[model samples]
Target: MESPRGRRQKRRKTFFLPLGTSDGSYKPRQRAGHARSRQTGICQVLKRPESATNTVKTITGRLKNARTNPSPKIECWIPEKNPSNTGLVILPGGGYGGLAEHEGKGYAEYFCRAGIACFVVSYRLGTQGFRHPAMLEDALSAICAVRSAAHDFSVNPGRVGIMGSSAGGHLAAHTLVAWGQYESDVPLRPDFGILCYPVIVSQGPHAHRGSIINLAGNDASPELLEDLSHEKHVTSRTPPCFIWHTWEDSGVPVENSLIFASALKKHGIPFELHIYQKGGHGMGLNAPFNWGAECLRWMSGITGHKTA
Candidate 1:
């Protein structure tokens, strides 16, 4: 099958709304605000859907990213169809300094075409003065909002999963391992995790230095680095995972994914892992070497979907 970008079809209208505020009665409003960044950017709220559709539609909106004013927001991408009742929330990779825009929606639309609901999340970047807990908080809020608003998005809350690449993968892994430990009235853990060429460690040459520096700060303590070193923290509580990476990826190193997979095995958490010989790093939803089909196939076993 051709990728969404390769196929020609009539584009459908998309919507953007604040996650908690939309209740099927939302009306589109023209408001100027930043788009998930401390830097000023205009983002408009879209009208809520009266009901779900079979075509491609989206709901993009802001979710709280920080505790203070002038903070960033999380952008949630709601797919048009939910026949599978499965939702996947995505976090794009940018080494904690920025977000990979194509990695966000490109993968979301790919899954949306497979009858799965997807939300592309944009968290606060460290370059904007946001730190460890900020990104994790925004990610947790996105998961909570997706679950709380599952009806509005036409997805099964229990089937919700999270996917990420590179640094974003680190955050996704962080959430899966630490969410249960977080004290919140809302459940924040994802049913599963998908990591693509992820940065899984905070120490060693295989780790991405920029990512660790951006997240833990330059003068980070040994305890802090160990805490963020996700491979050491994995346990049985961590959700099942799907991890993939290219063997020649010198930027982040394939060992990052290998070590994490090893920990997952140690805890006996069921997982699927893949390593490609080519396609270096940061190949976001590109053809010929993409993992979307395999990922969907793996998720099908977990969600009881007919197609993978």
Candidate 2:
């Protein structure tokens, strides 16, 4: 087999191609108070199945219909020089209500500067009346899209990983464990995971109630709750992970990361866990600690990339 660096050298320029769209005219809404960063190069909206559209009543007693629902999309970014053979799919946290541009676009820019290709996923949200498998489906789809087109993005297919913050971290952990349960043409399992202050418990004192309720509804079943609690789902098949959380994260308690890391240990999965002494929730790339640098170092070790 050719070396991964050799594959990077043959990479073509990246392009925005709709993965599962028909008309190819879907445009995601811009969340108020969050500006789109210039670092996000181009976006491609992936279409969901017709069955994905179901009228659901949100917590606010308002009806959300397919006409108003936004499909999942991916914003792509590729480095201009000496790109590494690694790709990352970012899932930003919004309590399942919105996407955090800083976690999405800001992370993309930071990682791209280190010669890593990035894809920021705008996944279906609970506030938008999506739930459970919908968010999971979108996450898997984004991974498949990036891996399937790894050459175009100048990354090795086997080096693609998933990263999420807060609720997005929950989704990333869920994807890591539950990917084998879903069927897909291309491999849907991420090679690794990077979780930042994720919400891991779905039905406990440590659970972020807003995220649990938004994702599974107030009437979620016991079995569903257990399933959504990603810590309960970790198996040997789950990939290696790099998890970080602040002890001062009041939003999603530090115990969430602890429990998940414990599960990883139980399954004999190699992982790196970082607990910062300070920093509140949603700090993104602006945390007092240099988590980005640490994560880059971890990526280099995993991918064996000298320049990562």
Best by lDDT: 2
Scanning candidate 2 in windows of ten residues, the lowest lDDT window is 54-63
Q: Give a tens-digit lDDT track for model 1, residues 1-308.
A: 55553232323232222332212232323433322332111232333333322223222222333342222344444444455578788899999999997778778767877877777777778898877777876777667666655655566667789999999999999998887655333356688899989999999888899998888799989998998999999988898999999988888999999999999999999999999998878887873475888888898887765442
- Native RMSD of candidate 1 (Å): 8.1
How many steric overlaps are in each model, in order? Answer: 2, 0
User: Which ranges of candidate 2 are over 4 A from the true structure?
Assistant: 1-71
lDDT of each: 0.72, 0.75
For model 1, the superposed segments whose C-alpha errors exceed 4 Å read 1-77
* C-alpha RMSD of each candidate structure in angstroms: 8.1, 12.2
